[model samples]
Every structure is written in structure tokens, then in C-alpha cells.
Target: MEPWEMREWYADYLDACNRHDFDAIRSFVAPGVRRAHLPGGADAWVSDMADLFHAFPDWRWRRIQLVVEDDRLAAHLRGSGTHLGVFRGVAPTRRHANVAQFAMYRVTNGRIAEFSGSADEVELLAQLTGTDR
Candidate 1:
């Protein structure tokens, strides 16, 4: 797919996320999708997303920026949510958190084939733990 097409597809995927439509989200993923920095496979991806929603029922992500080159897309995302359930073994703090993430995705045959990203885990953990660090 062209860069423009990929961007359009990405926008739709983001829309699916905003709606918490797991099936729609999975439709954009290739069966062999590999998330190197996290768990691999479509099931794992869905589980991770479900976990996030469980922790923050109102979690949302906004794209701060997006750049596409060939079949690769890079995105700067800002996410906000309220801690209402356990996350990564931390009990709910009921505090709101805003964090940033930088992600890269590789598209193959019009579907997401690979993904890797890094988020502000330190800040998120600090918020949950009520720590300054």
C-alpha cells in the first residue's frame, strides 16, 4: 500500500481503538503479526489491549504525530486514562494519568505485520505508586 493508503488504514485502526472494537482492531492485523518488544501474535495483542481497558475503562489514545515511509509507520501517541483497576500488579490508585508513547509499525499486504514501541512506563508507575520518582 502507498503511504497515503497506509495512513488511511491507520486512521481506521485508531478509530477502532477509540471505539474499543477488538474485532475491528484485529481485522487490521496479519495472522503472523509479531510484536517484538512485547508478546507476539494477534491473541496476545488483544489480551494486552483488554488488560489496558480493564485497568482504565476510559483509556484513550490520541495521535500526536504520524509519519509513513514505504510500508513503515511511526507514531507519537498521547494516552490518558483513570486508574480504576490493577495494572502490572499495582492496585488501583483512582488517579488519572497522561503518558506518551512512540511506536513503529510495519505493514505487509495491507495489514499490520510487526510492531514495536516504548511508553512512559516510569511516569505511569510513579502515578500509580504515588511516588515522585
Candidate 2:
């Protein structure tokens, strides 16, 4: 796929994520996909996202930046959500937090073949718990 096509595919994928559309997510992932190491990885990625959305049903992704090269795309995003349910083993405290994250993706045949992301885990924990990480 062309770089522009890859960009659009990525945008759509993020849109799906923001909407918590698992069906759309399935449409963009290869069957039997694997993530190298992330503690349950791809399955957990999807499930955790769903869990997050359940906790913060209004969470939204604000694109900070995007770069595309060949079949890979890097995206930076800021997400904000209100605490309304359990998250990462913590009960809801009605706190809201904004998190910045970066994701690197490898696309194959217009579908996400591999994805890895990192975020300010310490800050997220601190914001959620009212303590320093």
C-alpha cells in the first residue's frame, strides 16, 4: 500500500479504538496475530482497551503527531478520560487524567501486523492514585 493509504488505515484504526469498536478492530488485524512481549500482548491489548473504555466510556484520542515510512507508522496521541470503573486493578475514584502515548505499528496488506506502544505509566498511576509513582 502507498504511504497515504497506510496513513488512512492507521487513522481508521485509531478511530475504531476511540469508539471501542472491537468488530472494526478485528477487521484490521490478521488472524492469529502475535505481539512479541507485552504480557498477554495482542489479546490483552484489545481486552485492556475495552476495559479502559468501559472505565472511561468517554475517553478520546487526540492525535499529537504521525509519521509514516514504508509499512510502518508511528503515532503520538493524548488521551483523556473520566474514571467511572475499575482500571489496572484500581477501583474508580472519579478522577480524570490525560495521558500521552506513543505507538509504533507495522502494517501488512493494510492491516496492523504488529503494534507496540509506551506511555507515562508512572504519571498514569500517580494521577489515578493521587500519589507519586
Candidate 1 lDDT tens digits, 27-70: 98887789976778888888888988899899899999999998
lDDT of 2 by residue, 1-133 (tens): 8888887787898899888898887788765555656643456667767888888888888899999998888999998888889888889979998999988888887677787787776777689899976
Query: What is every candidate's alpha-carbon RMSD to the true fold?
Result: 1.1, 1.7
Q: Top TM-score: which candidate number? A: 1
Clashing pairs in 1: none
Task: List TM-scores for all candidates, in order.
Answer: 0.94, 0.89
Question: Model 2 segments beyond 4 Å from truth?
Answer: 39-42
CA lDDT of each prediction against the hidden true structure: 0.89, 0.81
Give candidate 2's TM-score: 0.89
